[model samples]
Target: MALRAHVGKLRVHQAASEVAVESVSLARRFRGPGAAERGDQLVRAALSVTSNIAEACGRGSVAEFRQFLLYARGSAQEALSQLDIARRLEPPMLTTVIRRLESRSALVIKQLGRLHDNPPRQR
Candidate 1:
């Protein structure tokens, strides 16, 4: 739960910062472009991944956490899909950002799976 909460906060912080930086420029250049909606969708999807995990952790049940991890994993895939779309409409600079986020999301999913399979001892 602590790990998920911490990672969720990180994801939110990173995603918010990334959007804050690119949103203004993207809005100007792609105002009338389809990428506008896509960009927003991608950011929200990334947020959903972490948010759901955090919410689930608060439930204080291994089953609930596992379910939420599934949601988080799904959200990660959704974000990745939106990223692929965003790349076509945006600049190459976003490449590193997307890659880093993708890696983190993957790692989080793996960690969640490990937790589900082998829960830690409680004090």
Candidate 2:
């Protein structure tokens, strides 16, 4: 199959992109001591998830793609962890949003794991 076609079929990539955008918006809500630093970390981790997946899809080999999937999974976990931390630090009003992001991150993690275990066959 063509690389473009394969990439287009990646629903996980779309999920990751959503997570990245949500994370950025959530980070903007952070306002307090050390908020800047924490937001920066969260954004970086969230961005890494999508970035790694994009890189993986562009790779020439299934092994390389799987490797980057592993990286993407790790980044998703990192982003989830940051969201948990934010949940504790932020006000009650933001809890729902943070939880939603957490759920999205979990979905991305599962999708990445599935992809890693059963990568697309190269032709």
Candidate 3:
């Protein structure tokens, strides 16, 4: 349950990677200093999902993978919350980008839930 475990060879699931990439791209497009700061947080949380999943997959048991996946899911939620705030605080120019990021976050959450329910090798 430690948060300091090594995350090696995360399988880079298609959905999760897409979310992470979109987040990073969105982070670079913010207009204001404040929005940029929040964007950094959003970016970090988005990237966390990728790392957490990789770490989970590296774990020794299905139970452990589930545990780390929970962490990843939490990060995804955190990113979503930050995105909502960014929507209000940011300028009007980034609306489409924000919407896309939100969509990706939602997708990551759904994918994480599915994987948690049926982890690899647990069938």
Candidate lDDT scores, in order, read: 0.58, 0.90, 0.79
**Which candidate number would show the highest lDDT if scored against the true structure?**
2
Q: What is the per-residue lDDT of model 1 for residues 3-121, given as tens digits with 9 covering 90 to 100?
A: 23343444443543453344334434433367668767766776676577666656565666668767866776776676566656667766666556556555655665665565433
Top-down lDDT ranking? 2, 3, 1
Error of 1 at 120 (Å): 4.5
TM-scores of the models, in the order given: 0.63, 0.94, 0.83
Clashing pairs in 2: none
Worst 10 residues of 3 by lDDT: 2-11
Per-residue lDDT for 108 in model 1? 55
Q: For candidate 3, write residues 69-117 as lDDT tens digits.
A: 9999999999999889888877788778888888878887887898788
For residue 100, what is the lDDT in candidate 1?
61
RMSD of each: 5.0, 1.8, 4.6
Top TM-score model: 2
| Stretches of candidate 1 exceeding 4 Å from the true structure | 1-32, 120-123
lDDT of 2 by residue, 1-123 (tens): 433326657999999999999999999999889999999999999999988998999988887888989999999999999999999999899999999999999999999999899888777
RMSD of 1: 5.0
